[model samples]
Target: MSNLKPEPANAPDDPLRRTLLKGAGILAAGSLAGSALGLAPAARAETSAGLGGRLRGVQHFGITVQNMDRAFEFYTEVLGGTEVMRDGDFFGDRIQNTLLLTEEVRAVRDGVNPVTLGIPDLRSGAQRLDVRFIQFDNVVIELLQYRDKEQPTGSGKAFAPAQDLTSPAFPRAMHVCFYIRDDVDFNQFVRDLEAESARRGMSNVKANRIVRATTDEQRLGASLDSNTNRITEGPSAGWSLIYCKGPEGEQLEFVQVQGHAKQVFDGAYESRRKQLGA
Candidate 1:
């Protein structure tokens, strides 16, 4: 989420890139297919487009957590992610200044009365922002823990395990989804998730059914059904998925996209483009 570069406009266009853009509208939709690098000359090339594309697809998924160690273990040890970088005690005068913390905010966090306060101090009550980056395939997960900070009221509790976070009513509610290898067995993955949940002593960490699109279903397109935990229709149709809760009750999804998933998405994108008269 930090040090992100800009997208290049002068990058030479490739046929595949053009085709993908014509189909999906945004590179992110097909980024997993390695189409994001189409603007660059080679893999990990240092071209401006390459540098920009790295920032474009997905640099990292940031997660605020109560305990960094627990989150790290859950991500790395349980979920088979690899730790790449860590920044402990990562806060400085410049960093604090960049955040532009006002005196009122600092006073509340520092446990001081802000109303009667005369001096305008802008330093944050937080001492350090401990952060760790975990790599999982093409994505990076940023696990952050705010240390020595005064937490607001009712902020101490983790997300409710049974909360319907996928509901459309909760606009900000979200889940991190991953694309699993095509050949891996979906049932086995579900079993592994169950085992991990039990091993971690998480009673609510359950895996949902791996929904695949079938012509027999009522819905004809790839759309998510939050209530049913099903992908009823669309490019993800026929693609299997499993949902589970992370260590901090964050929603997570693993999608099997090796088969007709791409075709489904491509068709959906193309349809939208046609409808829009693009």
Candidate 2:
């Protein structure tokens, strides 16, 4: 007789059977909820296909700043960005509704006791947000400045203390990364960044030493590499990178992709160009 016993039939106690039953129950509940919500069949199908089916590429990213003029000067002079538009003095019922600022939020902003509203105090206190769009070569950034309705312009009272984003370990800390143009010398670019900061009296802006991904392991582990399509030993096997701080201590990263990496990037760019018929 065979030493191994035949696998038992999938009973209710079986782990795999339990898991399948749970998954089916969840799916059935979701389908029922969708039907109750009057979701069209096509809409349900689209949802089942995932959000990527309806979503397009990124439009822009936003960063809140203390001083609009100072931030604008730093971005344009130091990093080479163009001013796109500016809008401000936003306040009213419509704006409040759009921002989902409830009465509790408004009460908190107005320095009212949240206990009266039967809720905890909300952190956001800005009466309005002034926005300026800056366009870089590859991306658009929206710079937002919160304003207090009662405070005078440029009084600095409207702004909150800056958060410490110096460490990547900080929760919600984010950095913008840019690619250096092929024509630009990577070493010279770092030198220029430091020089510009000093010349512009931006003491807060600082750049670290360049780091090179030279080994196959390093290339494979590069930030841009996808898990499914990693760059192991391609012509763009390695890359040069630098980390810097913006005037307000916002982290910035620059990369110059080398070897097979560049080839891969260029191929994608060409595909996008062809898709756009440009």
Candidate 3:
């Protein structure tokens, strides 16, 4: 949910990504097909569009979780995803539990320096078992578990890292949103969701009114696309949220968005604060 880079305009790949995106849109609607659709470049090149919402497609996401095994199953089996990679090469030793392979992890693993962003939570996390899984579609979801921490109590401020705040309050900034395509087969998707919920016996499964209102509020307040907003559509009023326990007992969210999920910055809503030297 961090926007370390505001715009990738200067990057050389922008033009190519745009071209591929157009082709992908056509492919989605079946306007263009032949051997071209089967070609690897046709799909690979479009991955960039999927990440930035440029294609009006998908927005990449990362979910913080506790149980790598169960969470992975929840994502793959329950949510209907195909596993691209089953091993951990991102970490030097393929350690079951680690955040994205940051360069500093080696320095810390080798006992040369403490891990970057190492804090009490990391230390506490070391006591437990967890894992990370990245899907082929450039959708990277990380699952975590704190042997030391308990699941979220949920009545108070969510302990996860709020956009406006620095440093995690509860730890493992919880929850993740999955922005799916607009044309997903609604009937089957809902039936499977219901079946999965029932089979998994997940707690607090509901249409979640708070999420719908928030989605509408963001769309209306920010002058953004309401129809394309994935968070605002569905029988659950176009969007739905379900509270699920992460592998570590921390509360996690399986959010289904109709269009895209965007990031929020501190003081981001001030209309007069556009970047300028005025």
Candidate 4:
């Protein structure tokens, strides 16, 4: 039997309605984590009030992809994500207005094809989007594919290629970090990642050597000064991390905390939990 299921109906046209729905999903996931961490209900309420009821936990992170199939394989097969949902046919007035994509739509209507801008000549309505949701443990990732209606078999329009994220230092660059569980062998995990990438011939994916932080200064310096030097005697003695690039050149990080570092983390969490009161 086919495992594919029908897509859910389009979300309501109201922007606020969509925001609330998205917020609900984030809250549902955040509540479980908060409860497990022993966050006090009253304190949580007060914190929200203090923030003017604006900020909440992240709902999901999205990445635009050129090839949905390739991105799906890299995320699911390589990174061990599970497909949660897939939806398409995202075009027309609702998308244009809601996403403020009217400029692109208007340009298309005025005969300003993508080819005129030196980009690929995508099929008509190339601004339309296809989305796939994948979940990795607690985090959800949304992979977006901008597509358009199919053209004739020999139509000049071609699939766009993935763009390189030249450097993390570039403006507006962003990366996602995944925390490795304490029980997982950090070295072996990286090795397995490399092996899988090799097996799949994912040439664009690359990883740096794992860096171990031996001192609290080194840990802090890694972020502030980009220092990777080792030092003796500090709380972060066993913290290890590695930076990598995904198939689309997106930056990623994996970290494993151990030794004194794990103790420090546990203590901090417990202290916060207690401060919140139960």
Worst 10 residues of 4 by lDDT: 1-10
Kindly give the number of clashing pairs for every candidate.
Answer: 8, 5, 11, 0
How do all models score by TM-score? 0.55, 0.59, 0.35, 0.65
Model 2 lDDT per residue over 167-232, tens place: 866777788877776677776676667678778777767665423456645633444312112234
Q: Is candidate 1 or candidate 3 better by lDDT?
A: 1
Q: Please tell me which predicted candidate would have the highest lDDT against the true structure.
A: 4
Output the worst ten-in-a-row residue range by lDDT, candidate 1. Answer: 2-11
Ten contiguous residues minimizing lDDT sum, candidate 2: 1-10
Candidate 1 C-alpha lDDT tens digits along 98-201: 44347556777889875344321223334444556676655668776655534321123322123445442377877888766667666666666657866886
* RMSD, one per candidate, in order: 13.0, 20.6, 15.3, 8.2
Question: Which lDDT tens digits does candidate 3 get at residues 1-278?
Answer: 11122112223533223433543454354322212111111233333434332232232244544334555666677765554322111111222223334545665677764433432233233322222334424344444333333432111122233234322245756454443444664333434454575577543232222224556335224322222323453333445344433333444444343322221211231221222111
Q: Residue 77 of candidate 1: its Cα lDDT?
A: 81
Model 3 scores a TM of: 0.35
| Ranked candidates, highest lDDT first | 4, 2, 1, 3
* lDDT tens readout by residue for model 4, 1-278: 11333221234553323433653575465533432223322233345444523333355678876566777788899888877666554554555455545555666788886445433322234544556677665567777665545622111222455555458888898887777777876666766776688688776676664245676445333432232222235877767777777776778878776677767767776664455442
Runs of candidate 4 exceeding 4 Å displacement: 1-43, 52-56, 100-124, 151-161, 210-236, 263-278
Candidate achieving the largest TM-score: 4
